[model samples]
Target: MNDQKFVDAVFFELFDENFCRYQDSLTKPTTGEQDSYGRARNALALLNSAQRLDVVEFLRVVIADTASVILGALDGVHFPDGLEGECVVSLDGVEIQGDLQDMFLSKAQNLGIYD
Candidate 1:
C-alpha cells in the first residue's frame, strides 16, 4: 500500500477497535495483564508508537481505505539495543514523533538492553 494509506490505516485501527471503547470501565486490555487504565493507555500507546514520518509522504498522512488503516496498526517499533525506547527515523535532524528532537539521547548513551 502507499504511504498515506499506511498512516491512515493505523489511525483508523486505534479509533475503531480501541479508542471508541476506551471510556468504558471494563474494556479488554490490548496486552495481557493491562487493567482498565492500562487498556486505555494501550490504545494511545499503540497510536503513539507509530512513526509519523513513515506515512507522511506527499500531502497525505492518512489513507482513504479503512482496511489499510486497520492493517497499519500492527506496525510496532524496535529501537537499537543501545538506543532509548523512542525509535529514530534517522541519526541526524531528520527525526519525527519517533523522536523529532531527541527525547532520549542523554539516557540513550548510558542505557543498556538486557534482552
Candidate 2:
C-alpha cells in the first residue's frame, strides 16, 4: 500500500478503538459525543501527518505481523488459502482471532465503519 493509505489505515485503527471505548458515553444531545468526536478528529489529524511513520513503528513493535495483515486486508490483498484463520486482530486490549476477512469485516461493522 502507498504511504497515504497506510497512514489512513493506522488512523482508522486508532479511531475505531476510540469510538468503541467511548460509544456508550457518546449519546445524542450530550457533550460526550462532541468530546469523543473531537478526540477522534484530533487523533486522525495528528496521525495522518509525519507522525504516521512513528505510529507505524509502534505498531510494528507492539502488534508485529498483525499490523501487516490488517493493512493488507484493507488494501484488498488476498492471503494464501488456509492462512486466513491465522489472522488475529487486537482492539483496545481485546484480541479476536479468526478468518482475516471475516474478522476485519465484523470489527469494522461493529465500529460503524461500514453499512
- Which candidate has the highest lDDT of all? 2
Task: Look at candidate 2 and tell me the lDDT of residue 81.
Answer: 55
Residues 1-115 of candidate 2: C-alpha lDDT, one tens digit per residue? 2344434465466555643344433222233234655554445445544564444334323342455466565444656455553344455555433344444444545644432
* Per-prediction backbone clash count: 2, 0
RMSD of each: 16.6, 14.0
List model 1 lDDT by residue over 19-88, tens digit each: 3454342233355546656655554445533432222221122222232322222222333345444332
lDDT of 2: 0.45
Model 2 ranges with Cα > 4 A deviation: 1-13, 17-98
Cα lDDT for residue 7, model 1?
A: 38
